[model samples]
Target chain A: MTAPSAPLVFLPGPTALHPRVALETRAALADGFLSESHRSPRFRACLVAMEEALRSLLEIPQDHRILIVGSATEAMERIIEGTVTRRSAHLLNGAFARRLRDVAVNLGREVVEATVPDGQGFPGSPDRFRDPGVDRLLDGAELLAMTQNETSTGVRIPPDLIHALADRAREHGALSVVDLVTGWPSEAVDPARMDCGFFSVQKGFGLPAGLGILVVSPAFVERARERQARGQVTGGYMGIPALAQVADRHETRATPNMLAIRLLAAVAEDYARQGREALDGAVRRRAAVFWNAVVDLPGLTPLVEAGPSRSRTILVVEVAGGSGPLRDRLARRGLLVGDGYGPGKGRHLRVANFPVQTDPMLERLLEGLRNEV
Target chain B: MTAPSAPLVFLPGPTALHPRVALETRAALADGFLSESHRSPRFRACLVAMEEALRSLLEIPQDHRILIVGSATEAMERIIEGTVTRRSAHLLNGAFARRLRDVAVNLGREVVEATVPDGQGFPGSPDRFRDPGVDRLLDGAELLAMTQNETSTGVRIPPDLIHALADRAREHGALSVVDLVTGWPSEAVDPARMDCGFFSVQKGFGLPAGLGILVVSPAFVERARERQARGQVTGGYMGIPALAQVADRHETRATPNMLAIRLLAAVAEDYARQGREALDGAVRRRAAVFWNAVVDLPGLTPLVEAGPSRSRTILVVEVAGGSGPLRDRLARRGLLVGDGYGPGKGRHLRVANFPVQTDPMLERLLEGLRNEV
Candidate 1:
């Protein structure tokens, strides 16, 4: 009468929910946590717990404030609106980075972009921050935006490069914001190094797709306050000043996704219990295994050039002919991988190496890939 | 090992999740709907089905469009940004109405408000829209905003009054928007009469708290286009044009709460099966029972004036002493009613009489109220 259960999903994100987190979310739902008032002390406790857990797991600095929002894209919009006054520069190499640039443009900000091919990393090395060309672009920009992990192409900007760019942006009197949507606890990056960074819970956290966790340094808050003082239209609900004021009291400017927030807190607590190094090591081990298998596969090649450029969390590979048949075969075999993003659709397969991916699931996926090839 | 389950929550909102909808949501979660890509046809079907179900249940006209957003507050922000070019007028009777007014002000619009005290309804009768005083306020306004059901005060504007005011706004070349956050389907108001009307899923829909359904008329869309043509900011992710374009394909502009959307579709489908008139009649019957119980209870008086002004969905009562001890007594007995909203915090209690309130639950709440008194 009823259809069979669907296979475990391994798509880029929202990735498979960790069973423990799912159980906690279910209990929360049944206990009426979702129905509690956002202004209630009960809900505030959830907020406080979530923030503390995330801070410990992400290693967020003491001065940084964590604001929960609707999505990572919203975080981008908020950061740009709250901080950018006159000009902003973007390092665009993939779809997500280009979206940040477009959001700035849509909000009427003056935007300067340094772009590279989709699958390629940002141009030049981290040392290029000293180059005059890079300095020229950053000169008058109020904010310099970059994607730490570009979900579209599975390319990661080296941590050294991100830090270098942030340092250069600071020299130019600009704040730097990074999007870590697909790369977070799995691949630890110091939140203290950037002015602001954000990620959605659906990616590395292996939760549902509603809540976006944004980390804002005190300097970023100061910039937002300056904009507010100038009576600029920072934003309405997504305004950083409003968000910070409410978050200070452990609340949101608007009603948030409580179930998702609770689930994230549970997941974050789990991560903290396992210890960050252990979790990151497990993720790295899984990534290594996945990368090795793809490299040995008959007709597949990594999307990003090998070395530090490839993302540890998202594995993208190009299919020699087309990816449709292989994807279909894998799907039939109960293994799911993401389709190519944007232009690469049908030509590449993107797989997630999130911490939640168990060894058995990975082995099954590899077997599926080998058989399909 | 675990603490006892939480009491049944009767908070104004996020209200209790209907058991049927909860079951559907849990099944959807297990089926991996939450993990599906926003661009996937699977997710699009959920969106399309939700819109169609809501349209059928709410009697939305053919020319009207429904856009799903993050919250009712977001719907307010989006409508204000998308429609109001320079000037807006608000009918402010309670906290929610004032919030709409504030949103316009925050977005930098010239807001002219016609205010009344918190416990009272809008000034004058429904026929007052025909009076010159209301016309004078609507004259130069680009958009006129009003709350059909002011959740904060438990005061609902009569359907006739809402339609009349909308007609007046149209005559004045302004679009009219209504906040039906706590009231919809429970009290059937024709959406064809207003340019826009919105509601959050947590209230009458008995789903989770993440999604807001916004119904937009063709006139509102045309006004948004005019604003866009004038180079005004129509919002980025919350923009009407972008939302409508994506909604045309049965998708949201950004990642949406898939679990909430699916649950809403299921609930709407159930409502449709039961018939709107029948559903509305059941709600009216429940409201009658609730009001009668409140009238009979000791040390209690209805907050809203008795005749035609009280909200059927949310019943507000002022207690003789403070409401704290009474609320505590109810909670101890496994009954939960909302604390008064805003200024009424310690002196009043707000109870929801939504369609999902079962007969047994109502009896328990009524019994609890009597015992507490």
Candidate 2:
């Protein structure tokens, strides 16, 4: 019945939003800053606050710059366009991994395809760079790209693996990029290890869509400038250097998504105040609650098993009779989980364990799975 | 001292926001649709509703398509990238007009420049084609582009000028594009006349900055596809055909600003109910209050002499001293107004008369100008 009109969202990408975000958003709306010119000192402060909050929360290094973009898709486009000139290698294990490959291809870059089957993980588990296929792809590549967490499948190749891949790319004399689209806040994507890493706020930050966060190393910035110098398109109005130039003034090249950006700063500042360890504990605690509830249902089991590859934030379960019926039954109880992504569409149900989803909400969701499903 | 903490925003852009838009934005944030999947039917409906509301409000013809972009700057990039292949003719007078030419040059397109002095608009009041320089710029150009309303200099080339320019472009076997960024809602940008027209919502729409509206004709769509066929870049992630394809499904290439989009739809629906004439009368009425109060101020006068060239929605006055002193003086009284734009930086003060700016707000601002300045 349309999920009881006001259901708790559990989608993978634009997951459950915190009421605090909504409250802060409303407060921002009421303030005069909502209508402030992006060039104003007040607007500049908002951008600085957002950047500083994110820096403190993520412990981002001084050398890495945070560039705000339109969306994660746009982030992907920007990273590939701004960084990769001739050859880029993609590690495709899921839909989003393939998406990077697609973005690179769309930009007419030479893509070195490295893929595993959709449901399968790299043979070396978390140490994917140890795999021969990945090694082959990195060879002779100008840049290597992979998703730190693949939302399409409930596969997360932890931060350590991203670090390892970056090291591998460096050994091969290539830069590295990471797509942490659904794996930030809950998981740290250490930017120091890679040339670039990016995500959107709607996934883990409990904010609305429309903001893309790109963390680029100084070398990466140089590479984008080099691309521009070489007569390659480094983003026209959205050119990497152009955005960075205005960003230094605490503004954007084009009018940015101010509402979403401000809300993100508030949320990030909240997380920083709470500290990352507490956030990690709470996230783990909530995932356990949902994982404990849904894993043993009749003919239903956790996808990716419990391993290094399993996602901590997004929990996916494969249903024997397709996800539609189970999701429909859950919908009847006002619980809305995500449908399977791509190949797993009807066969899987993806549930999120973001910080915004409180314990009691998870309990209610668990009860829905137990009694309703 | 800081504009009384809640000054009315009368900046040329990101203008005074309406409380209705704030309320509607808050409502949208509270709703679960904020976290809903962009692929969901509910999200599709939001897209459709926004499109329909705009179509009804702008009287958009059947052949024209509405594409939602990141910002008006992005809209300009998309139109130039999607439609223009080789050579483009730019009619420039003010900053934002020069911006399109900047965008074209940035995209590596061949630009033929035509211009009038900043304060002095085209020789003929409404019809710019009477100028020999404008006539020459149109010849042998693949596309003719000009700003319908120059936000920087308070000059508006009326709809009739745009229509006449479009006729000239067609006669020259070229397409015409118009930048109605600060002009829309207060001024109707008829999609039926121009091949492409665009604006951002933060202007006369009385909303926060983020969303951009692009209305493209069928012929314009065909031109974009043809550009893509010839292997020209038509916007990578924001490719016009790709955006149009998703738009048909009631979605965008990127995760859109659902909050802004929904609020815009609500506002557009509200305006549609009030009818265009009511909005026109209200805008003009509000302008009169501020204009009458400021026009005869000591050593102050209108920027554009008087007549068809002057902007009605954004009323700019030439302050004898740099606009800073007067703006700072008014700020002490909590009535914020726009400073001079670009080359006019210190010499002019721009005041907006959007529907959201109540008569009392303008009265307060005028009183500040009369008594303080």
Candidate 3:
């Protein structure tokens, strides 16, 4: 079936574009700015502005380097290829986290994984490692990987647990990398807590896909350099050293998604004007609205326990019946939410509560659900 | 200084976007299609349409697989990482070709390179290997890589020679890879001639940057699978096997530049309607106009020798009094061209002659050059 003339999309990611960002992108196209050389002063300014805006919006530390890549999956591969010389330890909670472990294995790195059930969130706070099994897996590993917000199951690792895990990895002389794909500004991330972290613009940032932002700590760069020096094969183009070298001059190693980069800068500038506290408060309010609306809906139950472990960005609900009919019903009303991911396919529906979802849109989605259910 | 309100960007790609393609992209954005899930029928139709359009426009053999990637540079890295088991050989003509060698070396592969001065085309016709040195380098190599058109120096390899080189590599049991970055539909590429070929949307296709199109033959896929089976590392997301697997269903490994992909399909469909002979003839006409206008211009000399060696898509000229001032002069007049690439730095200027450069723009550029020089 053909999509409606103008559908209100609320998919988990490749989420709705902020209207202002979309307008700016259209203007960019009209102005022929995409034709400019990546080295041109205008394009370079765009890149610099994006990097600066992200650093400010995310509170990235001075020691960390921000590199724009192709996708979050690409960032995952780069991090594993660059830092993991021998072994990588992964704490897998859902599809995305399991994909990280698979990437490491595909690259022929020795993998140690500690996996929980799909919908279960890791138990712990910032002060300690609650899972002894994961802690043991991190030992002797060159890289420790985790997903801050598991998109597939709507489970978010507590910020305190993330910080504690990075500390533990540091103690064991392993670099820590976190996939913040679905939990960046909305969920509140501190780049200083981890050696490297990545997020895609299509998710919480509310922009089109294509660009992946990778924040690298000095220690991570050093690890990659040491690995390269020791004759280990770090990748090209996405390699840490090459990316770092180009990023020093506010450039990318390859031609990037210039339109997305420009759009991100505009969105980041908006965030700057709105202030972090205000943005965070809006996200919190939206998450509450989403949870309250869906929690008691007939046939729908929250995927993750309602607590610190629930994701603020993506709200996943387990459906008693197959999600296909319900999703089709929503789509018929021009409302779109993500289908179940991986094994959750047809059983769960993922709704994104990004900053771009206006209150009216959220209300409409709720109205549609109420009518359908 | 700030750019003009509407500067006419002539910078060799990301080149100016075709007006129709840009409008199509804007319409797609307005439709909220970018937010659709990659697996959604709407988005899948887009991917399938793009692959089909490209195959039809470029006359790709039925056995070839067309994969969409992030950028041409990423395609280079993937081809090298997947195909080169231990030894790979490169024929270096310009910066981009040297980059292929660097990618191989950076990935810890043994690289053998045959070198020629920049702007110098390989000698001889399609029947024989003109350079014994290059022939020697290809021996015992698992993959032989070359560039169909080097963007750095405006050097285009004759199509017949490209096919002959692939044949030579096949005789040596090595797969061939060609970078048709700036020369594809405009240059009449035959996909059956090479094991694999790649091009970016921004260059020859006259679309926005970000999406790279890679065409691979069954032989290349077999080589990559064999290498993987032999325990050689074959990357993760951009790996040939993964890309091939995803392409079978007309999907990318990750969230791609959906907008660019859509734009490419539209442009390719336009090309399909226009037909190949017509497209090639237009390129030929544009090249003639560009050359005739600049051939007798004072202080400007063509970079490559005239005749079969000259590039039809990009024209490089050496400036006696430095290209910086001339380029700025053109920019102030709302015209832009590429600055010197690689070591050419301040001494040369590059102009793109893609299908998107309208007759009026071409005349305006010629007039601006004549007056300035």
Question: List-wise, what DockQ does each model earn?
Answer: 0.65, 0.64, 0.75
Q: Candidate 3 residues B1-373, lDDT tens each?
A: 1234666666789987777675787688777777887777888998889888988899998789998779999998999888887899898899999988999888888999877799998876876574576578887899999888889998888888888888888888889999999888777668998899998888888887898888999999988888888888788756998888888877778888888888888999998888877887887887898888787899999999887768888889999979999998998888888988989989889988887776677888888998888
lDDT of 2 by residue, B1-373 (tens): 1234687778877877766776777567667778888888878887788888888888888778889887888887878878887889988879888888888887788899878888666657435475676678877787888887788888878777778888888878788888888777768657788888888999888888888988888888888888888877676577788877777667777778877888888888888887777887888777766667666788788888777777778788888767888899888877778888888888998888777777778777777888876
Predicted candidate 1: interface RMSD? 1.7
Query: Which of candidates 2 and 3 is the stronger one according to DockQ?
Result: 3
> Which whole-number lDDT from 0 to 100 does residue B134 have in model 1?
84
How large is the interface RMSD of candidate 3? Answer: 1.4
List where candidate 1 sits over 4 angstroms from the true fold.
A1-6, B1-6
Identify the runs in model 3 with alpha carbons over 4 angstroms from their true place: A1-5, A127-135, B1-5, B130-135
Please give the distance, in angstroms, between residue A34's alpha carbon in candidate 3 and its true position after superposition.
Answer: 0.9
Q: Give per-residue lDDT, candidate 3, residue B367.
A: 87
Model 2, position B1: C-alpha lDDT score: 15
Poorly placed runs, candidate 2 (over 4 Å): A1-6, A125-132, B1-5, B125-132
Arrange candidates by lDDT, highest first: which order? 3, 1, 2
Residue A202, candidate 1: Cα error in Å is 1.1
